[model samples]
Target chain A: MIEFIPVLLVIFTGFSGIMINRNIVMKLISLDIMNTGMVCFFVLISKMSGSFPPIIHSLDEMNLDFVDPIPQAVIVTAIVIGFSTLSLSIALTAMVIERTKKVKVDDIEKKVGT
Target chain B: MFLVLNFVYLFILFLLVLLRRLENLQIFFFVSFMFFLPFMKNMDEIFEGIGGVHIVFDDTSRLFVLMNVLVFLGVSLKMRGKKKIRFPFVLTFITLNFLYASADLFNIYVLLELLSLETMILISSGGKVKQFWSSVKYMIFGSVGMNIYLLGVGMVYMQNGTFDLTKILRVSNVSLVLIFTGLLVRTGFFLYGMWLPSAHSSAESEISAILSGVIVKGGIFSILRILSFEPFSSITPWITKVSAISSFLAVIFAITSKSFKRMLANHTLSQLGFIMSNVETAPMYAFAHALFKSWLFILADELPSERFDEMGKRLNLFPWIFLILGSFSIIGIPGTIGYAAKSSLFKNTYNFERFFLILASIGTSVSFSKLISRRPKISGWGGIKENLHNLYFSILVIGGGVVLFEFRMKSFIQSFLLFIVGFLLHRMIGKNLKELRNPLERIEVNLFVISTLILGMILWLIS
Candidate 1:
């Protein structure tokens, strides 16, 4: 139960960080944090069954105590997607900053017509 | 076998693009080939048991896929000049195919991430500062929505040991709330669509059309797919409310905005509201919207500055005629597809929701009054001869509605009367209408996320 609290705390912390930040890079970091928290939550749930990795040495010897591999595989995929998304967004922000010389949302907001 | 065949269809397009430069003729042939592919598909087929994921090809997805291809053909016709956009445009087109076919929640997430990422690349491909900022906002919104969606997927998986959508039953309602809230952001509901007017209006017209017409439908399709199950059908009415609210708010914004493209983007939300409020008839409405909305965007691409004050006096002969036709179809004149689609959607709903939808329909006309009331200048300053291909949409909107669906005589007069009222109302308030401080003009992530949370909490209390 306490371990679950840390996951929830991390998730909400990132969520709040996203809601409060006006800087674009900070928002991106918050988004990454939230993503990491969700991934960790998935990992925690998959680990509830066992701490052992989802590895089976022999085809016939099936280890029942091993954690579910599917969710782990899913997180691995999620991590890859998250990484790509983060990098692309960072590159996009870098381009924006390079062009406008504005990093804060307020300064940027006045430039774009409402 | 079917999945492999689908990949093969896209792969051939990929090869054609990668092998050499593709001309307009090559693109036309590719569009026609993919357009014919859906007719060959086996209906109601399920491809399962390979993994825990559920994948199905039913009538709804099949029809959506066909409509997307038809829209693609229309878009590709206009996609002549920009050789760079055509590649991402085609790739995003293929991603949409996979998105529509996805039945599992995880597949939807992955595909949505991919679809929006490709769209981000397309939007910022102009390499302009403004486009980059808007695309970054799109990227941020996409990642946030997908992450929340992931949380819901995790919870669902935790409760029911599998990700197969068909197998998940008796799941808690919180999961539904999380899922709905997350997907609504992607779908551009009232709170989250604040990013839409900027993002949609900023992207190139072709990309805007795709974003507005088809891509957002990816999330709506997922919501409808999830709501199709028996245990979760209870949440349908709330979706109706949410979409109704979104359309109404969007209409309010569109009516006041002076920018031509921004108003059109807002109306995309309104029409999407029309689609979402009535799920049973969504496919037909989605198809109709994809055609005409893309039609308008393609025409918008030809114009210089997208301002309403200048639009009437500046448009050439080709765009003026199509603009009037698109507006008529959008306002649901008696013989157009908009009339048929709106009539059916309104018929299947009732009570306050029906009233809300009716108000939204009237609001649609009122917003479109800016376009409808414009008297075209006869002298063509510029000949828009390059866009002869848009004739396809013109023919469909003009005659397809009556032939495709039984033109309801009962509501014909009602819609006409609604249009008159809307027109008169616009005329009365038209002079006074000024651009309101649109909360959506800037990317307000803080406000959007806060409202989403509040909505989630309210939904939690309700459930």
Candidate 2:
């Protein structure tokens, strides 16, 4: 439970970073931070149940204590989605900087008045 | 066997992407394949287990699949001569088809992520800097929304120990609110949908048609599925209240918007209010709205992007004629598809919600009437190809009217009266309208996401 405090703190920091920053790249980084925090939270919460890996190669292992496997699997998928989102967002940020020469959102808005 | 069909379709689409030759034949084959899908219906395995494709042959899925096929067919018409467009276009359709059939929670989440990613790719394909920015904003907001969804998924899994929607018996109020919040954020219900007008309006008409027509409704459908759970049915009344407020605000915004495309985009959001308030009629309204909204977007895409006051003048006969029909379809005139769908709501809903929805519909007609310009005395014949395109869409709209002629005579007269009142209202304030800026700016969307999640959590705790 104590470890959960830092994870919540990190999530809050990432969230405020996204809300307060004006630069697109900064926002992308903040989003990554938030995703990492969520992944960490999922993994941490799953540990409350058991300490061993979820594998059961033998009947004895089946009776032995094991951590939940579902959240671990979900975390893997979430991490992959997070990576794709980060890379694509970075690519878009590069394109934005290429055309407008400014990473600040207001400057870009001024350039293209959308 | 049902799941295998999806893999086979993906393989074919991949082969099409690789072998770009004979593109016309390939498109014809794919369109025919899609249209042929609805007839091979089986009622046996409506509820499949986790880690497998889940589909049903119920009324909503039927309507959902039909709209998906129709939009794909319409968009394919504009794909000729475009570079690298067919790949994502077909990819998005495939993802949406699977999404409509998914019954499990995790399956829906994964499919939704795929849909979002593919749509972002499609939007950025336009090669304009504005399109890139809009796509980027879309990605940012979309990822944030999904993260919130994941958080809810975590809570549900922690509480219920499974991600199978049918297997879970009950959920705490906290997780339910978190889940609904995630769905609402994606649907762009109310203030959270600031990214919609810019993203939908900036794309080419075909792309915009799909975005406005089907993709937005994807979020609403997810919510409908969630609310149908017996434990969560209690939330329906609250959702109806929220939707009424959203409908009214969105209509006001649409009525005041300066650009025709933006006005139509807001109208899309406003219609979500109507569909969400009544669960029984949601699917029907969604089906009709998809047809008429896409028809309208396709027609509006042909007009120049100048203000309504400027471009409506000196219009050709093609746009003029279809524009009226498209508006009629959207306004639910007596003989249109919109009339059939709106009449369904009138039959089922009663009291304040019904009154508010009707007001919102009239506001929709009023706002659209502002875009209507008088026919020029001497109209020029436009490009033959474009006129043919208009004629094609007009036939579809008229066909919808003819096919959906089951509404009562009273429905026609009521809608006609509403249309006249809306037009008179439009004439009064048409000149005073001004441009409304995007309310959900980049930073603000992030704020709303977190605040909404927190609000849901607090509401859950209180309840």
Candidate 3:
């Protein structure tokens, strides 16, 4: 259970970073930080058992010495998903910035006034 | 077999999206219909593990998938002759086919993120600055919610060593609470629903219609899924009270809101609360809310502006027919699908919760009663065929009321009495409806989320 402490710390830091940023770009950066933290959190949970990567051609090659492979695969998938959403967020923020010409959400809200 | 059909559906949709020339509305409609046929064929039984061990199909998924397809068909028809939205509309439906059917907890997260991203695209696709702002608001909350959900998934994986929903070793309460909070933010729960009205009101009508109707239901499957785990049932009872409070409060917000579309948006929030309070019968309530609310939104766009003050003067080219049908359905009059769904929802609940839900319904009736009083101009009668979607859903709402098994004279009397009370309240409140205040309006989004998380934590620890 102590191995989970660092993972929880990384995630909590990322979450706080998200809440503190007022600029959309900063917020996106904070979101990326949080997602990266989560990705690492997923990967590190499996590493507590073994450091060796799980790569085997057949069932016979499987051994107790290898780390769990599922979380590793999921983290890669998570990274890809995180990348796509981040890029989409950047593109959307660009559109908003182009219109409002302001980076802070508070400033933009004042100008847009909707 | 279901997997193959989904692949085929994806193939056609991809081609449609990639080749702009092939993006005609009819082809999109044809593809959605072709994919829906199999679901209709297999509606009677659950197809467990059809394609993979991780994927599970059951009655809840079936109802949601049906709503997704049918509402898409209706909404796409409503967008006919409109330019510039063809691409995003096709793209939105592309990922939705997989969102409900997949049973893995993590898979649902990715699909939900994709669905929300696509919806943001669609909402921003309206090409207005206000629309951009609204979608931006949604993206902020949505991103935060899903990240928290991912963290919760990690916590679940830490305990269970697996992501499969059907097989769980153990799930801690805090993790489940985190997951539930993430979904609730998107599902438009009471304090968390601030993003909903703005997002729903600012988008183009058809887009708002679809978002309000069912796309936000990304949470329903997981909510129901988590509720089934016996160890985690501690949080179950609080779900009802939370949803009921949101339902009644949202109706209060709707009754006072001055903007026409925003009022409709608030009602969607309120109805979502109603739908959430009784998850056993949620699909029926959801289906009812989906059809009629979308119809109201489509008709609302026909008005000149969202101002209530101007609306009282004249409604030129307004389709009063659809409004009347939708209002009757919304207010839960005796012969509409809303009545049927609400009655069934009420019958299964205790007297106290039912009374509170009825109070919410009374507020809904009061909110909509004002709309029915407004008189539209002569042009409303002439252009009935132009709105094929209205005609389509109109039949469903009224027809569904007739066929639903929950019909009872007691239910009818309660609903009728509520309708009368709403009208009297509307009359007393009169024209100063705009002067009413929304108490939750002043709460900051970030603060609201933190407090809600704390609240969920406290709920879990106590329960």
Model 2 off-target regions past 4 Å?
A1-3, B1-3, B25-41, B47-57, B376-389, B449-453, B460-463
Q: How would you encode candidate 2's per-residue C-alpha lDDT over B255-356 as one tens digit per residue?
A: 888777778888888888888879988988888888888877877766765467677555666667778888888888877778888888778877878788
Q: What is candidate 2's CA lDDT for residue B214?
A: 86
Q: Which stretches of candidate 3 lie over 4 Å from their true place?
A: A56-64, B21-23, B41-53, B229-233, B316-318, B383-385, B434-444, B455-463
Q: What tens-digit string does per-residue lDDT give for candidate 1 at A12-85? A: 77877776888989988988998899989999979878877777788765756788778887788889899999
- Top candidate (DockQ): 1
Q: Write the per-residue lDDT of candidate 3 for residues B1-463, one digit (tens) a residue.
A: 6656776867866786677656457557667677667666564432444212266556776777777777778887777777677766776666666766677777778778877778888888868877887777777677777877777787887787787776766887778777877878766677764678878988888889988886866666567766766655667777877788889988888888888788899998888888878768887788788888888888887667667777656565446767888999988887788888888888888865677798998999888877778777776354566767778888888988888846578887988899899889999985675545444432245445655665667586768
DockQ, ranked from best to worst: 1, 2, 3
Better of 1 and 3 by TM-score: 1
Tell me model 3's lDDT, rounded to 2 decimals. 0.76
lDDT of 1 at B354: 83
Count of steric clashes across candidates, in order: 0, 0, 0
Q: How high is the lDDT of residue B345 in model 3?
A: 88
Interface RMSD of 2: 1.8
RMSD each, Å: 2.3, 2.5, 2.8
Which one wins by TM-score: 1 or 2?
1
Q: Cα lDDT for residue B414, model 3?
A: 89
Docking class of 2: medium
Candidate 1 wrong stretches, greater than 4 Å: A58-64, B25-41, B312-315, B380-385, B440-463
What TM-score quantifies how close candidate 1 is to the native fold?
0.94
On DockQ, the stronger of 1 and 2 is 1
Candidate closer to the true structure by DockQ (higher is better), 1 or 3:
1
